[model samples]
Target: MKVTLERNHLLKSLGHVHRVVERRNTYPILANVLMSATGDGLDLRATDLDIEVTETVPAMTATPGTTTVPAHTLYEIVRKLSDGADVVLETDGNDQMLISSGRSRFHLACLNPDGFPDLKSGAFTHTFAIKVQTLKDLIERTQFAISNEETRYYLNGIFVHTVDGPDGVVMRAVATDGHRLARVEAEAPQGSAGMPGIIIPRKTVAEVLKLLDGVEDEVKVELSDTKIRFTLGGVILLSKLIEGSFPDYERVTPKNNDKALVVDRDSLARAVDRVSTIASERGGKAVKLALTPGQLELSVTNPDHGTANEELAVEFDLEGFEIGFNARYLLEIIAQIRTENATFMFNDAGSPTLVREDGETKALFVLMPMRV
Candidate 1:
């Protein structure tokens, strides 16, 4: 195959697709990117066994054919070339690739394109179209809480499904790592009535978010029982759905906690960050929280090290209590809180505490209190 593609456009497409390729592979072709030159343009594709990404860019197709070349090596060569240079790629009879531009040249060992595992855009039974902003919001809101432990394979990705809520149909995304839980919901988009509740792998979620940055038009999505597909302008991504069942998250949310403590988000974040500096140097990453009549105090102490405490005036009522929590976790959840004031509801120091936006009911965070 022979083709001529603009250097920067090729680099951009490679940058987007190559992250999915594994560095060291048991299979030879999995390390390569599939380049297809048609009469109009060239298509670049890369995949691990679980996720696949494809991007099309304009190129002059001198000879129409398909071949596989090392994904990372090609990207590096093009990246180091002159800024506005054009890249010419051709394959020799012995399965080697020749890449040339200006004074630099490269010959990379090529693999048989037929050896790559099948990336089928299988017939999808359901398809829907939604605004790109809607999809981005859903991911950003709840992706932080996804579990990283490998034992509970089901909890590794966000649970995205439609459910019946008090108001009507709502689209929901939920994630939990056994210690903290984050749930977000919004009005369902136009044609997702019968869409299945699926667990999108964590890596796929990150990749999709990256792809959305360049696209302003609507995204067309298609899914089946085992796989899902996304189509944006001139690009497509396919991913395998996680196989296990997610735990029932509804039973975990607290029904009632009368103690309502409202604290400013920015102030709380700053205080927690400062106090945690002392606590983190010790162990357990635990910090103490005390809420009294007029002021709230954050303190952390380690017998071997030192201590830290900060006071802030907060809105609170009823009795006083003390609790401990992972300082980093609290800071992350607070960062996601967009409202001016965030409310914390606690039953006691030992039980799981509930956090919500000052007046919003649709999104809430549940955190298991830690012992310092």
Candidate 2:
């Protein structure tokens, strides 16, 4: 294979595909990226068994052929090259690939392209197109709540499905880590009415977000029972779905919490953060929220570090009640609120608390209280 491309184009294409390659791999071919040079362009593909990404870069092709080389090595070499330099790639019959740019040159061992594995995307049952901003919103709002525990494999991803919403059909994303839950929705795209629920793995979610960053174009989605494919311009990402079923998150959403407490989102977050400074990290950084008619007191106590306290004015309908929660969790939820004020609906000190933007219902959060 022989191809010559601009350094910037090569670096951008390599940046997109090299991330799929793991630093450590049991199989030799899995550690390399497959490069195919044709009259159309130069195609680069990399995979780590579970996920695969491919991108095409425009280049001057002298000899059309295919070969495989270390993904990260090539990416790093190209990244260090001077800007605007022309990069040349050539393969000899001796099973080696040569990379040259100005005064720099590297000869990397190559593997047979025939050995590269392919993740076959079977016939897709559903195909839909979603606005870039809408998809980005759904993911950013709920991705932080995805569980990292390996035992509950089903909770390691975001649950996505379409349902009949108040204003019509809407697509919703839900994620929970047992301690906290986030749910957000957007208007459903055309042809997504009866789509099956799917759990997109955390890694895939992250990759999709990167591809969507700063992009104004729409994303094309095609999915089957076990596989999902996302196409963004010249880049394609395919990932295997989690086979297990996600927990029934709707049942846990509290609906009867009546006591309303409204507080400035930024003010409450700062107060909680300040008071938790002396909180013991091993003790969950628990912050106590003592709500009175017109004021809220935030306090944290640690036997080893002493105590910290802060007060904030708040609007509460009920008399006196105190609740304990992880300060980190509280701040994370508050950061997602788009409005200036956040409303908390409390049932009791022991029950779960519901939080939302002052008057908006499109996004909601449920936080489990901790025992202080």
Candidate 3:
């Protein structure tokens, strides 16, 4: 088999498919990308058992055939080649693939494409289309809270479902890691109502985000009980869903936290970052926030690294309270707020604190307090 394609087009297609291939794999085929050249174009596919990505790029096909070669190696080779150079690919019956561009040539061992595994996508129960930017917003607002702990496998992904909202039905994404929780909602898209609540694995969510960048077109999503598929432009991604049940996240969201404190989002985030600088590694990175009627004091103390203190005038008129929080978690949650003011609703120093953008109900964050 022989195919000739522009170097830029080959590099772009390889970039899209090679990321799914792990650097090390137990199976040789899993480490390689399956390339099928037809009269129309060249198809590239790569998988790591759980997730698969495929794309087709236009090329001049002299002979039609299929083979598999190392995904990363092919990407690197094309990436280093001179721009605007034409690339030529050929496969021989001796299980060898040749890559040539400009004056450079590479010989890559080829695996029979017949042995490549296909992620069987059975009949899908639900299908929907959503704007790329809207879908990106839903993932970015909550993905940071996904758990990494292996024991509670359910919390390792974003829980996506449709729920009733004040105005109407809205699609919601919730993620929690026990210490912090993020919940964000958007207007439900057509054909999304009554859809199954599925947990998208962390890796798939990350890949979706990367693929969505700078995309102006809509994304087509198809899903079943066990699998999910996403199609954008010429690229397709399919992955297995997490099978465990996500906990009832609504129960953990604080409902009656009435002590309201509004502070400049930028100022609070900077203050938390500054004070935490002196926090020792042995002692957890905790910053104490002491709120008064009109002022807020942020302080951090470490026996090994001394102490830090800062004050900011805030819009707090309720009863004063002191709360401790993980510095890293606080900054992450604050960064999600798009408004100028970040409103914190606190029940007490021990209970979880609810935070949101001023006058915004679409996004909310809950943070557990730490003892300082």
Candidate 4:
């Protein structure tokens, strides 16, 4: 097998799919990327059995064939090559891959292409087109709240489905990590109505986001009961669906949190950032937000590293109240706020609280308060 591709083109293509390759692996072939030549380009593919990504890059095909070579090794070698230099790759009958650029050359051990798992492209029970920006916004608004705990596999993804929204039916995405929750709504794409919700695993969400990078064009989505495929421009991604149901997130969100406080998102972020500096050293690492009628005082005490405080003038049209929260969790949800001002609705210190943009109801965040 042989192919000739520019250094930059090789690097660009590898950047899209390398993240799917696991660093440590049980299968030898899983560590390598499968390279095969098409009519005028090379197709690079990498997978960890659960998720697979494939991309096409322009290359001069010397001989159309396939071989699997170590993903990171090839990426590192191509990355260090002189910019724009042409790279030549060739493999022997034994699967040893030879890569050459100018005076530099490398021979990396390769695994047989047959062992590289085949990505079974399944039929789409339902297919649809979605704007790139809409998908990006949904992910950014909810990804921060995705649970990282593997044991609670059901909560480790962003739940996406159609719901009867305030403005008729709308597509919504929800994510929660037990401590905090984020929900974003978008006008459901035509034909996406009535589509049942699906929980997109965190890894797939991240990879799909990376694939969407640099692409403003509409992406084609095909989904089945067991798998989902994302097609955008020249890249394609296939992922196995998480085989469990997500938690009842709707029931967990508070319907009416009476205490309302409106504050500038940037101001809240900065105050949280500053106070967390001291909280980072304390047990439970909590931050206390004491809200008065017109002032919001943020404070954190370490008991070992003293305390930090910041006061922000806010539109707190409520009685005196206080809430304790983990400093990291508060900062994460606040960072997702894109608007100038944010609004918080609190039931009490012991109940779940809701947050949203001051004037927008499209996105909502819920956080469970901590006992500091």
What RMSD, rounded to one decimal, does every model reach? 1.3, 0.9, 0.9, 1.4
Q: Report the lDDT tens digits of candidate 4 across residue range 1-372.
A: 788999999999998888899999999889899999867799999999999999999999878888889998889999999999999999877459889999998999988888889879677677889999999999988999998899999888888888987688898999988989999999988878877678888999998887787788698888887788889888889998877887888898889788889899998988898888877543667999999989999998887788899999999867898899888888888888888988898999999989888788899899899887
Give the higher-TM-score candidate: 1 or 2: 2
Local distance difference test values of all predictions, in order: 0.88, 0.93, 0.93, 0.88
What's model 2's lDDT at 45?
Answer: 95
Candidate 2 stretches greater than 4 Å from native:
none
Clashes of 1: 0
**TM-scores vs. true structure, each candidate:** 0.97, 0.99, 0.99, 0.96
Clashing pairs in 2: none
TM-score for candidate 3, residues paired by index:
0.99
* Candidate 2 similarity to native, TM-score: 0.99
RMSD of 1: 1.3
Per-residue accuracy of model 2 over 14-98 as CA lDDT, tens digit each: 9999998999999999999999999988999999989999999999999999999999999999999999999999998639999
Q: Write down the TM-score for model 4.
A: 0.96
Q: List ranges where model 1 is wrong by over 4 Å.
A: none
